[model samples]
Target: MLKIKKKFGIDELVNLTSILAILFLAAAVVLPHVRAFRYFALIPWLRGIGLGGLFVFLILQAWIHRKKVSELFGHRRARSGANSALQIVLFLGLLVVLNSIAAGHRGRLDLTSGRDFSLAEQTKKIVKNLKTDVLVTSYFKETNPSSMRARELWKEYSYLSPRLKYRQVDPDKDRARAIQAGVKRYGVSVIEAEGRKVEIEGTSEGEFTGGIIKATRGEQKVVLFLEGHGEASPNSQDQENGGGLSTAKEAIEKQNYRVEPLSLIAHPQVPASASLLVVAGPKKALLKEEVSAIASFVERGGKVLLLLSPQVKTGLEQWLKSYGITPDDNLVLDYKQHYFVDASAPLINRYPFHSITQNLPDSFFPAARSLSADRKMPEGVSAAPLLETSDSSWGETNLLSRNLEYNEGQDKKGPLTLAYAVDVEKKEKRQKTRLVLFGNARFASDGAFTAVGNGDLFLASLNWLAEDEDLIAIPPKPPGPQPLVFSNGQMMQVFYAVMSLPAFLLFFGGLVWWKRRRS
Candidate 1:
């Protein structure tokens, strides 16, 4: 003990104290992220005591070198050099501190022409008003482009509110943890809140932000799609036949809704928890019992969405007529403004002032039919057109005709109804039944849903029907348009200007130097 005490002199003590002070300060900066460091008993004590000991050692060292310190201070060169060093140190220190504060309280400016880098207002509102903390963990390979893109996008979420925290994990380096988290593939993310988790497989803003919303919102409302009469399957991937509604299903799921195939033939009654029932593009006629079950469900204040294709016999004429809704059998033809390939695929840019169609873009309907409401509607039932075609469009009587033309007396007039929203209320009861009818289901199918505002329009309709009006109006921010292509001659001019300017300057400089040396 005497030898050890002799070896640990004042000079050695000062060095040890200085080193300890640096370590403790580093721990203070790093502990928040490490989390487990706080459990160490020595860290808290070291933070307070280490810094104090450093100050004491500094004072003692100064006292021991009093004469030398006074001589150094008196020398003009030494004082000037010390002042210069101090000024540099102070300037660097200020820079570091300002940088840290700026990073912590930074505001993001999305200067992209389309505001593509910014989150939607709806998403910002949701994240800002979150009641619980939502953690978004991205599982991706370090070298993946999607990982970088995801990091850039999720930065907005982290900056929007304190409740949202974004984290990225290298799945390859942390294989065990990634597997435990159920991340089987790269470029996927997991959002967790309140013990509930939602996995997003896509990197689009719609998918990731939707997952955050789903995870934060605890309960999932069931959206049942009617099956059994050869309607488009939600699970189908056949894009050409319009047999898939995967895109529509995903959009609804993002809004904290669950999509399930519901068959009235298999089940006697609609599930009590069914938020909305969708009957989309049924080719075969529904059984009488199935129709009865749907009627019962609607009578009990259930919401319904009916998407009928042109000339498809579903045998719901009487059932629809009871609600003062008429589904026309004629085919919708847009000769003036239609998809390039077919005139039957009408391009509809007109929308009425309704919640479902508000802020929606032009939607293309392939093989669309027309809808008409009774002039005298039922007592408690009110109807309004949600989407419609222009005055140039007409409901053609013959869909089989290769050279189609509007028949004078047999076909419906121009400006036909393509979609309608209806509200049915009972006077004595508080229950109300809501319904939406779309002339064409193919537009909302997987193949065409992402085109224009088809997905947005469908989501809005579902939100209104489910009484979730708050989630209705948010639209996806598409990326900016591609830059203009330059011709080879134009490119050559740019190349020559960039490459020759510096060379020309260097040549002129060398010539001037040569002339001066010769002179």
Candidate 2:
């Protein structure tokens, strides 16, 4: 060993130094860049380790073998050149082993600033609890932007569960497959499970997750929206003024619930098949008979969701008081936690461990009213607050005032209740009553439904009301314009890296060729 080492001399030491550089590069590529170390970032340190090893090793080799290197390539076919082949083969074998180990793990780390690539907690829950095989088929051009993005997302999904499979095809290339699947256009994803299929467009997490939910749903429940009191139409998609419940309706339907607008005037009684009743933002007063019919529905162990806007005389307010949920006649105003430029839209971030609000983020209620849950409740009735304003919020009595300020004595101060969940049960053969009350319906309207947490809030409320706690997962995250923009300095660094790699290899190749030609 010593003889061999002495014969090779500095060249052997230089080869050992190259091993260090390769190890550093391999580590940098394999490990995830989750955080920057206190001393330095992972990539930069790895780069420094590799380049520094090469530099120091080269210096030592130059000093030791100065006499030998001085004669560039005059030697004819030196026997020493054959030794590199064995080392090269061994190096390549090491790389194959490292990459195989990495491939076996089948996991990836998201490095986006907003973590947009990361799946929501709800999506994980849905995928992990899958009971059957699911296939996601996409009809799109391979090079299309949406197809590429969907494929990237599917890489994570494929790792999440073995039950979820994905396949993509270029519609132009596979016209027969596209036609068989009933897909007429591109950019469509069909999630199929248990003989059911949900077709969707777009590549947002919310859109894909929603399709999974529908495809995997077991039973179809019914949600009836009360009409005829100027309530927001379930079919209206107008988002200009925020008076449409269409988005909310779609969200409910995604959870395997069939949503239908019910006109009490046409059929005075709540149907027996209704899983829940939604009275969403009624502007005009409900007729006496209509209000009576809703009361009858609640009395018979039915679930009800009542969402209200401020300054409206909803006749059910007094009726609701009898059941322990009271409506305050004021607009909730929050100066601290609110949407951008609007204090009227109180933003709620934290929540108690209730099933509805447990998995939600910062949500805002626009032009909302206040609801007071009765401390002294009726027998077999209990209420819990679902949504609340910030500490600096207030309930304004004079909503019509041109310039509004919190009245010290007249107005209510800070952390007012915006919504409540009421549970009712009795020791009888009849079913128990469940109720969810909200201060504002516009939170679920088309204008605000896709807000960070607005749509989830609506869906969670429905889940609780329908007694499907398992379905109370978080809604799809609302994606924003998060285009990756590189700085000029960063771009220049990347450019140098891109150019230097091939340049180094070409120079080495030229040196090798010059020596061989002399042979």
Highest TM-score scorer: 2
C-alpha positional error of residue 387 in candidate 1 after TM-score superposition, expressed in Å? 0.6
Candidate 1's residue-wise lDDT over 29-105, tens digit each?
Answer: 67645523323334445455555665677688888798998898898999999899879967975775566455545
Q: In model 2, what are the clashing residue pairs, if there are any? A: none
Model 2 segments more than 4 A misplaced: 1-98, 141-146, 169-188, 237-240, 398-409, 478-519
Q: Count the backbone clashes (under 3 Å) in each candidate.
A: 0, 0
Q: What is the TM-score of each candidate against the true structure?
A: 0.67, 0.69
Candidate 1 deviates by what RMSD?
Answer: 11.8
Candidate 2 lDDT by residue in tens digits, 83-107: 5755895687577556545554555
TM-score of 2: 0.69
- Provide the overall lDDT of each model, using Cα atoms, as 2-decimal numbers: 0.80, 0.80
